[model samples]
Target: MNRFNIVYYTDPLCCWSWAFESTLRQLREYLKDDCEIRYCMGGMLASWNTYQDTLLMVTRPAQMGPVWMQVRQVTGAKLNERIWHFDPPASSYPACIAVKCMGRQSKNAEEEYLYRLRKAVMLEEKNIAKPEVLLQLAEALDKEAPGLFDLPLFKQQLTDETTINAFKADLNERKERNISRFPSLWISTQEDERKSLLITGNRPFEALQTLIHQF
Candidate 1:
């Protein structure tokens, strides 16, 4: 049996995840052979009420116009700042369910849809909280999200309170550990079952290459 699992906990709406994209992506490509990695959703927003608090949420992207330029320059990704005003604050719940929908409906397809969802929220600045936006994004994948909306599996899986609770519990557990921020990976190998080392956040290929060599 696989004794240890690598928990890659992240929020789809997190800015740091956007910055760390290039690096974490490299890790996935390079380390797939040596270790088992699974993608898990960290629900960043549970309700719309929570969004009213953050300065980033209530204001238009024009409020922090520099963030748009900075993120693009750093990550080489594009974002549509107008999404903040045109749509609502990105809730990530709909996108989360969209990912769950993909996971339930198709196996490999989930990852692709998840990446798209992340790009929509992080780079494109789309309101992922809205089902309509999520449905539209899913449409690009040739997925009929509107149909899935009524499906018992999607309704149950996507709207499951237990799933959110579980995600919160996992987040709490990780927080208690106080390891580091999102986009951080922990590797546990059979040879070393004692303690795990924290990988630096959003680094180059050399960082992951070095960590893999540690095993």
Candidate 2:
């Protein structure tokens, strides 16, 4: 059995990425031990002050509501678009940095923290850009899993230069790979180190399953 690696490039506040959660969960269960999934934060939105997405026509925060609604209608993912109107996030960089901090604890912690961030902004209408909100989520995770996470260490890492550098590395990786969209994947098999496939945007479970089989 050949093992595979999947580099998942995504942002915490991306609507399409949130919609693809179910598909990702199914793919994970189906693959089991055959694949290793690594996350790379794409820094989708650094700050609205200098942000202008011509494709999505999302120059402002309020324009994002219809985009989320469209994704919900198409993917049937439960999303609250009111966040854009109510407490919109100014940038996704803070949440992305928080995820890098969580990764210092463990891979599981990193993944769970990312999911919590997505759920907070997408479904719960919480502002993930705030450090206090991010810390509260970490505390909740600590309560849920007890000693799986070190609260003091996690808090320190949030502002540490090392964690911020790690996130900057992810941003640079995305740029080098020319990945301009969320929910992008770079898949490669152990048999060939130089060859890989890049799939962007949200894809169905069967499409991913078939792609894995081809490898």
Candidate 3:
């Protein structure tokens, strides 16, 4: 049997990840049975409020508008650039915590919750960074599975550190381990030897499926 440790690192607020969601979905559809997956956070937006006046927040999505179009051209996923004008810059940490919270609740539910989050923001124009909204999401997720917001676990479970040490460590380790690209795949041996091949950003499902089979 061939087993792979596939690490997916991305930011919730990242527009590229939004474009890549279909690829991510396709990657899992083909690889989940054959691989052990790990989801890691790479902090893309540190803070949203501090940039209340700066162009960093104001201009990022403006920049993303054309990028979304390009990504749509390539990936064929739906993204509404109107969100940039309608919603404020999300901190992405709260959304990240929500993901961790869902994962802590159910590994299976994590991706579903993530999908909901992306849909809420990217499609419906909902603000997912708010506790009320997250709580609502939590309620929806919890109805399907219980104790998701049991707090101490979500608080204590690497959510804080994933940004601080865990995130930095993962970045440094990726460099040391020589894994490049956002959604890169690093195949690992039982002895923990690593060989990586870049999957690149948001390609067709068939391309990723071939990569999974090649391993």
Residue-wise C-alpha lDDT for candidate 3, range 59-138, written one tens digit per residue: 35455556556656766778776766667556776777667655655666677777788777777777777767766765
Mind sharing the TM-score for model 3? Answer: 0.73
lDDT of 2 at 196: 87
- Total clashes, candidate 3? 0
Q: Which regions of candidate 2 fall more than 4 Å away from where they truly are?
A: none
Ranking by TM-score: 2, 3, 1
Model 2 pairs whose backbones collide: none
Which candidate ranks first by lDDT, i.e. highest? 2
lDDT values, one for every candidate: 0.61, 0.92, 0.63
lDDT of 3: 0.63
Each candidate structure's TM-score, on Cα atoms with residue i matched to residue i, is 0.71, 0.97, 0.73
Flag the better candidate by lDDT, 1 or 3.
3
